[model samples]
Target chain A: MPIRGSDRTSNRRAGGSPQRRLGARKRNQESLSGDPESCSPSDPRQVFTRRYRASIRTGQEPPSQRCSKAIHQGFELEVQLYPLKSQLVLPGDSLTARFIDALSAARLSARNGDIIAVASKVVSLSEGNIVSLRKVRTTALARKLGRKFEMLPEFAQVVLNEADAVYGGVPGVLLTLKNGNAIANSGVDRKNALGDSVIPWPADSHRSAERIRRALNRKFRKRIGVVIVDSRVTPLRLGTTGLAIACSGFKPVRDSRGIKDLYGRKVQITLHSLADGIAGAAQLLMGETQETIPFVLVRGAPVQLGGSYSSNSMTLPVKDCLYMSQMPSPSIMERDHG
Target chain B: MPIRGSDRTSNRRAGGSPQRRLGARKRNQESLSGDPESCSPSDPRQVFTRRYRASIRTGQEPPSQRCSKAIHQGFELEVQLYPLKSQLVLPGDSLTARFIDALSAARLSARNGDIIAVASKVVSLSEGNIVSLRKVRTTALARKLGRKFEMLPEFAQVVLNEADAVYGGVPGVLLTLKNGNAIANSGVDRKNALGDSVIPWPADSHRSAERIRRALNRKFRKRIGVVIVDSRVTPLRLGTTGLAIACSGFKPVRDSRGIKDLYGRKVQITLHSLADGIAGAAQLLMGETQETIPFVLVRGAPVQLGGSYSSNSMTLPVKDCLYMSQMPSPSIMERDHG
Candidate 1:
């Protein structure tokens, strides 16, 4: 059932929605004190916590009450975005094993429907997508595109070499199509790699997610969803938000085409891509700058799970996308750099 | 302090950072049963929640123990994104008053440093930005642009009339600049409007945010940050993410210009736009087909607060913007309708 205004307005700490008939499982979590507190002004953390406390009192369930939780429970409400701190994964390290170990340490196991969001970087490392810039031979186009973007010659060459198509360039960033996903630097990241080598998006990130999900399921013996995510710049907006490179185990888009709005009008053109949305939500906790959090836990997202899905389920070709199709093509990159 | 990998692996809840000194406030919240449970495979929520419960163990802090938190004693850590449900807002209704009442009904009050994110639609409603399609006379330009975007003639007229410039069109959407934001249909929204009239973004969203911030402060006697957000589609990506149209009391951009990454290299091109990220997180709960939530509460996010900021802080000139500068100008729109 959809959450209502009154359900939230009620004084109950959990905003306990009426869907609760499974009373046997409910725990007594009423007296959690991790709710509200006034923090120091000068400390940004204090200010943030202080501000968070005030807002939480009127409109939220404290993190303590919920703890580290997503518990899909078939609807979306009262949620936390948990970015776990983890040590850097060495190239060829078993990311699945590491994640399972971390979750186990923290006392977590995959349920039949949990979605594990792993940064594409670690997946690339595990898949051995890392390549030294020194090993890449620079091409003429790479040099020109690199100089145009004012990027280092090797990384620029890497971007060109990896891309399916080089669309164009803006200051400090490039627009390219790598394996059907539109990304910057062709999904090659230099951030947080162990040494001189940069990491390319896993050869097949969707498969990577599938692999991880299967391994986790084998260990816990439960079906789970997995999405490999990376950061990319949005047009006209500075910085990046998480975009799913690959996903498995759920329909990525929540098609709201025939759903009625509050006015009873059938909503059209309102397809909510659930995987990308979840990735973006995860990005809030895993900020840019290569955060130590390579893994994020999203539960209780109320998504359409079961029946495996691929990253291609939500991806459209360049000719099919809204803005990418209309933009100038690779010829723009071939234009005179000077 | 940056979150460490070992802390997460050590098996203590809250990641047990050695940096923490507020020992007396910490609680032993083990034995919580909200982890993963094997439900029928078709029951995705049960599965998601089940996986979540397992992950929640061994690693996360329980709510009861972190009671009345923020010793800040220093720093910010894990956080939640809460989307609140409220009734439809009428034109000229006091958004601040409605928000205050809604929050009050839910037992939440504004506290020092809290960040209140109000959807630009409601803010526009409060500021009387609703307009009638019947009253809008279609111009030759509007009809042509409308035909191009496959929109209604009068609605087309509004989009054209509201924009500073009509850049171009794609399959199902148009690109326009309303105020400084590159948006679809000049940011006019019809989803939750009362009758035939659609609501446009506030004339000066920056001023609207500033007004809300000031009013809330006067009412609560506390300094809280306010961000006016709207959903927009990103280039090359389907679906919408939150974009900040206006903000008050924080630097929306987190300048990580000289900060060191894990590799100890001075990070560049990692400047994070904090406001936009929070909005994206909020969107995870606030689906586009018009859910009950128009206001989102974000607390404990590490953002610079105080001394006020304008939407311009997160925006760039059209010439300086990465995407807009390269796009075809109005002359291109004026060039051909045939």
Candidate 2:
């Protein structure tokens, strides 16, 4: 049955019917922790967890309960995404400390081996990666890019500055290669920020992720992985899903080479992108709007934790990329180097 | 805590460490059905739920139970994938009935709005979509392709027959576009079957999905969606994730056009591929080995049910495809159309 919703509130962020938006502020929400010392800020409005509230509308067994018996019954291959809502992240705030505080507010503590997915925008925000478009001086190439893509000259300059290589564009969206990923506008975002201001990717995603991982480890006295995530569109697919810009504390790819298949044939080219898959699940919970869920705790993912890897581990070289390798033109590569 | 495994079985299908492979054959596997009349044939080996058993190894609460209280405490946004294992599917079996029986065997009834992800290989097997390499005659082009890609001429013939367009490849893999998806060997599989036989995509994916969806709705007396899925490698990314070959009973894409973003700017190009995301989650559970889990029941996925859509609804036209449209050479298109 469709999860029924109750306690209507005008929430545009969740991007569902009006009835589906059950603002967490009206509910008697409790933290997962029973610690009396736990505290939440004055405004306990958690727009991100509205999906959870929507499940309660029909007064039926929440899906967790419906499958609770399955766990005891010996059926347990599953993955869970918990979108942890927090106070508004401000520039220069310590992400690790802020995340810990958010977990406290949510009453959820970091569990050992949980992979926390932090939004790249928030990472940028904390790292002071904001740029004011009003101060940008557009070059001739930037103006040409603006006219060609139907974007503002200042925005185009920012995109050019961030993108490794620009391929082509539709009106308002440029297809660019950034850090070995084919992303829109090199992962520059205009939404969720003030006027004429934009947030780009963190300067060093791998380093950013490592710092968070170390901090969380120290704070919780537990082992956990960190994945820096950004919303990305798949080629020819609709809507956005999570992409791992950088990750720490795990082998990002599960290489299946030499592994025997069901028929006893050795696997050739199968490397599962563990980080990206986890990121996509987290992004599903962290909606595009002001859901205020910059962190998602992913538990029980089929990943081998306790390893350090670079962000490059998640990206394939252009010569090895399925789409880029197939392109008969060297221009896409030449332009990247150019 | 890492879920530890109790029993040990030599399971190459689950693709994990030895202790992690908790074969389901030894457990008191009771179906979700309390009814004594329910049957699970002679062998009730559910190698798929080994992950669940592993979770129980540490004497800790299963992740599901750990989050159970979250449901009652006004937190509810989550997605759960239940992998259902069944008998070895042979050619010409009725996929719909087989799926229903599998669900019954697991004692998990389908709830309305649950999306059932069926592996496309199983669908192809049931539809008699298998080809015998021994029976095929390799043409000159097939022979050329075989030498170039280090594949059998007979297998190359089959790939050529199934591929919409051919691209460059490495020693043992061919990059091709099949049904608007950039897939290896045009979605043909040589594993899991007897010698010299290969499985390709179902003849008509949309029709296959609709038929399965219709049968499910009738049998369960509940509304549900069906997605035919196949494991696919992402461009430049490692390993295989789920790709939706076809879907029925829902709008595959969530068009966010004209929707306001977090900052109230109208969303331009955000079409969420609900089917693919769900498919990927299901694939994570349905591993590449002989797990015997071809069907996964996904609950509470952020998707709207109740719609009829074409398979084309999930794919982009070549001209509109992000990667395809960026190629500077007309050769790829020419080869495709040729």
Candidate 3:
């Protein structure tokens, strides 16, 4: 079955104002005529004629006009990451207000279905989550951890306090699981903080993200998703990419249980981590340097808006984690050559 | 240090033709004037005035005219993912040639500095890396393993043959380390394969990516990077996203050592997994289902082009893996609440 323009408009108009429906139609027409070739992969013209439609699905498109034309007269989807620069965020500052200010200052409005990815550091800074090393009381375990990982005892105490589970680490970095996500130093950091002070990842990042999302939604009167982005190192991988510590206003993962493969076989275990990918894309723009790009507006991301999901929707139990559960002993690991 | 247009042109024009230099300049000017506000984060006009110049850096831009306007005459970086739909690829097909064909058929020519991401499944298909389960002579160990994992003995044998180390499994999936990457059943799958056969991940994904890169470079005379992508499920995360099994023609990991954070502190232990982020972004476009998009052209990615790094540049030793190295015993893991 081909998805006609009428079908898309009808689905899109649901819960949307007649004015917005007219606006979307007007925008789509303008986009269709402007490039004539920038059709989405889900567009009926492309999906039905050139390729097989495993199923009919409609994805939300942001109002941004930037797109790359793929195949003459074909609709190709382009996910755009707009890194938003901000003023120096201070302790107890309103993150939602600051973000709204930044957007309006840039003359860009938050549209319906837009994703706002903010670095967790700024989120923590705004929450006044910083801890002074001088105020920290070190435990015996903290002192031992500091000696093992080459860190100050006060810093180690903070790490231990924030960590859900402490794992061994190479010198200078402690690996831990914080809120079910594997992170370095339990997402504690000294950079961008006062000397002799550190900031742990926001307490209950999921709730923080939801608070910001709710505020933004109320202010903008639009359906928007918010993801608290954090830089994380993966197992055996170098450098840091974005990880979603928390997400709100969308189903962060796409379940592909009933989806058919190219051969019509049902894909059993394919779940798309929409939040992580959005975070990674945002991290690509938010450099680790002194640039003030704390907020990234992700437009045209393929995500379902409006879902009541748990904050821990993306986390897995330690016993169920692939790398954690299946870790072999050192001798067994040494026997095989990678 | 402010990076001028002249500086970027000089750095980009090294070992290149005068014709291309003019083309890049013309394109940049057209892009600058067309949007007026479409400057790169590295663009001096934006970096010097509003944002702090942590350091001066210039990144490559593909020859695509798509970009979003940021700030009042500010330069913004827009990384674009173009998912490409290809014809049904059969065994013994020339992947490089087929990719070029797909690009040309779409009227999109390969551009210099463009990162091409190809699905590993298709690469295996092109290499005819399929096995008939009937031909496999499963050992007693394989039979037992199959019974435990609810897999056929022949399939378990193939997995054992490909895997470097097998730790454990849930009922239907076995977690194994293949080429230093933790994956399921050593990247073997029956989807899109013959009913009685399964296709394993390409034996040498790194070399395969290099092969594609060299062939494309020869054909287009462009310095392009190729990444062999495969969908992977992360630990404790739902849904699959793109993972780069092999990368060629660029440094897949960006070292952030000695870089200054926003507080002028020397940031350590931040290596950006450029390949993985690129793969994840491409995966966002390449659906897990019957969408025939096997290749995604990534443009405006913040990767330093023209490097001779090894294929395993993105991999880390198992002992050094954060999740693998620090995995606790069942008793220790059980005591902690995550």
Candidate with the greatest DockQ versus the true structure: 3
Off by over 4 Å in 2: A1-74, A101-107, A328-338, B1-76, B104-107, B328-338
CA lDDT of each candidate? 0.63, 0.67, 0.69
Rate residue A41 of model 1 by lDDT. 39
Please list the residue runs of candidate 3 whose C-alpha ends up more than 4 Å from where it truly belongs after superposition. A1-43, A46-74, A104-107, A327-338, B1-74, B104-107, B327-338
Cα lDDT tens digits, model 2, B1-338, are 11111111111012222232232221223321212333332212222123223332322222332233332222334466667766667899999878877676555777656789999989999988999999999888789878987999998888888887776676677777787776788899887866779999999999999999999989988778899988776656656777889999876776666656666776555677778777777776676764567898886666667667887778776676666677543223325433
DockQ of each: 0.19, 0.15, 0.25
Residue-level lDDT tens digits of model 1 in B174-248? 677766677877788777666678778888888999999999989988767888888777665656667788888
The DockQ for candidate 2, computed on C-alphas, is 0.15
Q: How much is B42 displaced in model 2, in angstroms?
A: 52
The better candidate by TM-score, 1 or 2, is 1
lDDT minimum window of 10 residues, candidate 2 chain B: B1-10
How far off is residue A53 in model 1, in Å?
A: 27
**Candidate 2 vs candidate 3, lDDT winner:** 3
Write one digit per residue (lDDT tens) for candidate 3, span B165-268.
67677767777767877688789887777677888999888888888899999998877889888887776666676788889887788776776776778876
TM-score: which candidate is best? Answer: 3
